[model samples]
Target: MTGSPALSSRIAELEAELAELRAEQAREADGAMLKVLLDDIEKRHAVERRLHRAEEWLHLAEEAGRVSAYTFDFATGTLDWSPSTLALYGFPLDEQPTLGRWLAAIHPADRPAVQAIADHALQHHGDVDHRFRIVGPGGWRWIEDRGRIVRNEDGSAARLVGINIDVTELVELERRASLDGERLRLALAAGRNACWDWDLVTNQVTWDQQLGVLAGVADFGGDFDSFWALVHDEDKPRVRAALDRALATGSDYRVEFRMVREDGSIRWTFTQAKVVQDADGKPVRLVGIDSDITETKLAHLALNESRLFLVSVLGASPDCIKVIEPDGTISFMNSNGQLLMDIADFEAIRGKRWVDLWPAEAAPLLEHALSEAVAGRRSRFDAACPTAAGTPKWWDVSVAPITAEDGTVERILSISRDVTDRKDADDQLQLLNAELHHRIKNTLATVQALARATLRSHSDPAQFEAAFSSRLESLGKTYGLLRSGPQAATLSELVEAELGPFGGRSDALAIGGPEVLLSSNAAVSVGMILHELTTNASKYGALASPGGKLAVDWTIEDGNVALSWREHCGDPVAPAAPASDGGFGSKLIDRLTRQLDGKVTRVWSDDGLSLTCRFRQSAD
Candidate 1:
């Protein structure tokens, strides 16, 4: 095909023309294919335009829903804020906010954080999620922003797409809740209260450490239902009502109930709660407090019961019961107690002295009784009691001790019964018993003499028996002397009785001691022991010699009663007289000493035998 010149020229020219035509045809075909491709591309771009428009509408819708979008071109140092973004910045929708102006709207405190977050996002080409405060036309608003770095093909951050939401209301609500939480924390710390948080959506509960202790549940192991189960059956309904009311109307809730502790103990508690809601007014959380009041309630109830019992017992008593302080104040009086003195004015009697209410004759009796009672005696015989109305009354007064915390006798509780009606009968009975005892003792003495006389006349046994009869007569005489009254005889009377056998010369035996009166027990033991000792001495020691003389002396030493009997002007006592077995008289002396819880000592001296006995000076 590449041949000759003429032929070649003609052919070449023709070929060149053909080549041109082929090239043109090829160009046309290529142009046609390109046109078709361009048409298809334009159709696709038109569809994408429609989608892009729909996406823009979606973004606008989101912005209308309290949201705004923003973009920052860091390379160009430019910012583009949507209408919502402008409005969020408190600027008109048409207003254009520079990057610096937009940043200025952020709270100064949060600006650094926002910049740091942006810088990090730009540097790492990473997503950023942040919240900051901004001052706007309305007030300080909280803006929660989220954005992603738009990276260029070279992996460098080119732009930032972010959305800012006005979370001012939510943040304010959170702040209020935080304040409430702080207040509740203070209250709990002061009162040792417990707290609870309930999540309605999750149906779960969180309990403070103390609430777990109150409910007796493990702090971390209980659910809301589990905690509710611990409420006492009687209080569950009320607690439930409180919760329901709070949830229904978002009102404050308050209820008091009992809870069953883990250890099966019951506790009274007061609870209060408030409901928290979302922006849509849907309940989100319940915050409450619980306080234990069991101990206080129980103590109050017990005190009430005790007071009632005390009042009842004191009131119902037939005898007059009075509480009188050491200072002579009548702190309390039963009905009978007030009536006893004809004192209707309780106020006047309150601070008045009890002694001031006594009649002249009864004053002595009252003083004596009070003195005896103050000496730790439980009771005393009051011959007479003076009344506030000038009446003379007799009472068998008994004073019981009421000690205070400091170990002092704080009050004297007196119980007195009116014995006026029975006084005559009691006196007559006492006289009759004393007469009967005296008569019987005299008759026994006479009978003993008669029996001795009969035995002696019948056999000579009377001679030995007469000695015993004489001693019995002496004892009868002593008894008659003491039965004269409530007072027991003195030591002088006792010694005189025992020495009567010695006749007129009994003066040879001297006796001395305190003038104090002897109690019945002391009088009896002393009389028996002295009588036996005198009889034994007459038979074997001092009185056995004509020149013998005895001296008896008694005294009180410390709290003990001491008595000594010594013999003089007689044969010196023999130490080796062969410690004979004790006779009945010696044994009697020992027995009497034991009965008196006393000590007896016998000293054998060159002069004679000296005997001393000591006994505790008590009424026993």
Candidate 2:
């Protein structure tokens, strides 16, 4: 920590030099020559102080920002390397190298640029800011050298001060980045481009090779003016104004402007620049790259056109197409859907729940389908539903789940078709078939009865044919009327249909019964049985006289049917004849009663005959 007394005395002598400088400035104001000399000494002293302070700063900076320092004294014709700088090159301070020795230590490939930069600074008295390579203990390393010439009192070059930063890693990263940028620029420049830079400190401009080409310059020619000259007249002012605002606000730079190409054709170019600021918070530089996004713009236009086409198709589709969520929330509905719901305003129905639009009974089915769809199942179902105005309709619906990339169900695609008309037609056909079967069965029975009756009575074939056809036709009409009831025909309707041919007025037939619904089979069987009984009665029972009246009563008791028929007046009462040896009418009634799984009881009365039949009663 201690220095020789002579070294300390040398420091005191340097302090005296500073004192002399102060004294000279104060005492020799009127002596122009003295004043000049004093100014010169003071300048030299300041340089000395700066050199000392710069040395201290270099050490501090080396530790602070991991950089070192060096200088070349042209007056002494020697290189003064700081201890840290020498240490960086693997040289100890006592073994300090000469200027030529240090230069020789630089890698051969880098020495040329390193020497040239220093030479240029000495020759022009200007500053040198450049990068060079130095071979050290750590192998070849990058060094950033920035120096300015210090002039002597006699206006001669005296010294140079510079800082060297170990920028090996920074340089490598920069090299890779530069390569990447070059690759990107070349790839993007198959069309055209304009690259620019704005120095916030000096407001100076820089351009790249593509800028000249985009501006129609035949060659780069290393000129900035060429780029400015080709800026379109309409875009020049705007670009200038934008740059001004960017500088003032330190905001990101972005602009789209037209630049004339080499062939004098104009193409739009877009540029986006980013500013780098100094420690003082002032933007020091901006680097920007320009590219043509024309194809991207054109694609957006085509996409819009395609979307319009799809929208038109959706609006016109015949099926009641609706876009709905898995939970049955409706998002969109086509024209057919609007019509099906009787909604003239589709907007009013948007976002409504699909189940709410359907009959309440259908809600459970809808919920089940939605749950299955969410579970990733495809489901389909058919339902009879009432619409908004309570008009019943049938719909066949299909649903499938659509999922996102992560396999989460995102939407359910549902399609439904109204099949009410088809269903109605099918029901009508079934009814017709059933009715046809009933008619054929009754007609066959009638023919059978007529054949047997004609044989037993020795009637002629023509008479049998006339009687059988007439009776069967009457049965056919009766069956038709009974089949068309509100729900199921009443016992009275059944009797009237079968005996209407007998001139039985409404008042001539009496009916009493609890309400019951008859299945089609039961209806047909009951009608035919009544027809047979009435046909025989006209010839033998109460209905045979104008004063005679028929009474019918029925009740559903303990799930079984009890029915009674009373025939009075037309014929005199006779004792019950045991089972007739073969009356065609008797046989037919017996067969129908058996077909219904019932029993028939006949009572001979003075007034008429009463027939009662009991059977199971079933609902349709």
Candidate 3:
């Protein structure tokens, strides 16, 4: 609407003012809108920067942790893998990813279980956390996957997004640690050892089931004092001291002590412990194992007793016994053995080579014997072992192997006996036997010659028989005296033996002789002579009559033996004159006298007959 001129001017001015105001209001509204727009853009830039930083951090964490992100589309059965995931699955980067390929990358043996778990997670739309093995060009790798299933609006499975981590090193470490723990447990069980842990502050003790069994306790409480009380009275102070020292010095503790069980039986325990300390270096815990060592301790005691018994037996042995090591060194020798070896001090010969103790000539033989013994064969040899004083002696040495429990040759046991005297005696006996054989052969020949001559001197068959019988009897008596004596005989014994058959009456026969032993040869000759004289006397000289008397005497003069024979109070005897057939008795007397290297003279007197013979003494 238009106004009057004066009114219209004012109205126009007011309208102008109102229009300016409106314009100003409009300008204010536009500036407020621009401010709001600028604030929104800055806020968006800040959010974008924060998102970028978060992404960078996440990528850094994934790389540092060897983790990879992956996604699987359930509808298309498609799989997507990060670079790291592809490397883990041994898939080339250029290769297309698929669910089938991912399943194929799983270890054949683990594929079924992995697929079932993944299918369960997909159907349930649940989260997944699983560990599985993947086979690749690099052998095998362990993977830890954690993800959640994404669902569509209708709750059906859509896809799976997850992070895969290469946990091969961790898995290997866990496997090795588990194996080591199993091995340790097995070893402890085999050794009859028990594990224990102690809390130093509370003085509380914890023991495994094995420890309770060892203590004969059905249910052992964690009372430290009860265990301490189980220690033997004699070992309590020692055990306490050891623990104190270990705790004070932060050192390992090891001790062997006797423990008293609930049944009052004693057991040997070997404990090894490590002290665990806190940051302040104060001991807080003690971890250790206790091994039952009663059997081992008893065995050691038995071994010591056996060793003592062996030493006693060796010391008392009569033979020289030596124990040589496998290297031929003399390991042990008893007192008796040392004495036999003429060594006053055992230490002088100890640790010395066994072969070096023998003379050079015997060393090789001893070495060979030792070798044979070491090879499981017993060897025996006789050697001349010279003493330290240079006295030669013979020894019969036997070498035998001493074996260990494993049938390995541990040492050679050598036993020696002295046989020097026995050897000498044997040699002497051999010589005497040879001489006796020669003497017996010569005697037989002489007897044969006498028998033939005796037969030749006789005429009548009956007379030849009687005369040969008497002569043979005389020869037999001579041999008997020589055979019964030891290399020699006394003349008086021969006379007594020859006259024993005639008469044993002292009044009828008189024999006198000095104590003279005759040589083996001379004794035979003298026996024959005595036989002849006694026979002649008994037949016709003195012994023929009841009142006849015979006297025989022998004397030693200047190393010569003189013997005389006289007959009396009997029918008078006369010497037979030389004839073609002289009596065999006479011939025997003459031959025997010549054999003695002596002379014989005969005198036929009125009262009696007398004969005298002289010879050099030849008895040894």
**Judged by TM-score, which candidate is best?**
3
Q: What is the TM-score of each candidate against the true structure?
A: 0.39, 0.45, 0.46
Q: What residue runs in model 1 are displaced by over 4 Å at the alpha carbon? A: 1-65, 73-77, 91-96, 149-159, 196-205, 213-218, 223-289, 301-305, 308-316, 319-620
lDDT of 3: 0.77
Alpha carbon deviation, residue 128, candidate 3 (Å): 2.5
Error of 3 at 475 (Å): 37
**Top-down lDDT ranking:** 3, 1, 2
Task: Candidate 3: give the clashing pairs.
Answer: none
| Residue 262, candidate 3: alpha-carbon lDDT | 85
Candidate 3 per-residue C-alpha lDDT over 1-620 given as tens digits, one digit per residue, 9 for 90 to 100: 22213334444565565566556656776777666655655665576566557546656767799888777778877676666677778889767787677888898888999999888876676789999999966789899999978789998878788999889999999999999988887888788999999999998999888888777777777868878888999998899999889999999999999888889999998999999999999999999999998999899989999999998998899889888998999988888877777888878888999888888999989989989988988999998888766778889999999998998898999999888888778866884575456445434544454444445555678976776667557656655885635578888888877765443245778888899888887887787677556655554567654566889898998878999998784555444222114555565677667767788888766556688988867733
Candidate 1, residues 415-453, lDDT tens digits: the string is: 888887688688668855764564464345444533443
Give the C-alpha miss distance for residue 258 in model 2, angstroms: 17
Superposed by TM-score, candidate 1 places the C-alpha of residue 390 at a distance from the truth, in angstroms, of 25
- Cα distance off (Å), candidate 3, residue 84: 5.1
Relative to the true structure, candidate 3 reaches a TM of: 0.46
Query: Of the candidates shown, which would achieve the greatest lDDT relative to the real structure?
Result: 3
lDDT of 2 by residue, 256-361 (tens): 7777776777766788888788898788898888876556656866899998897788767656777778667888777776677567787777788877887788
Error of 1 at 177 (Å): 1.2
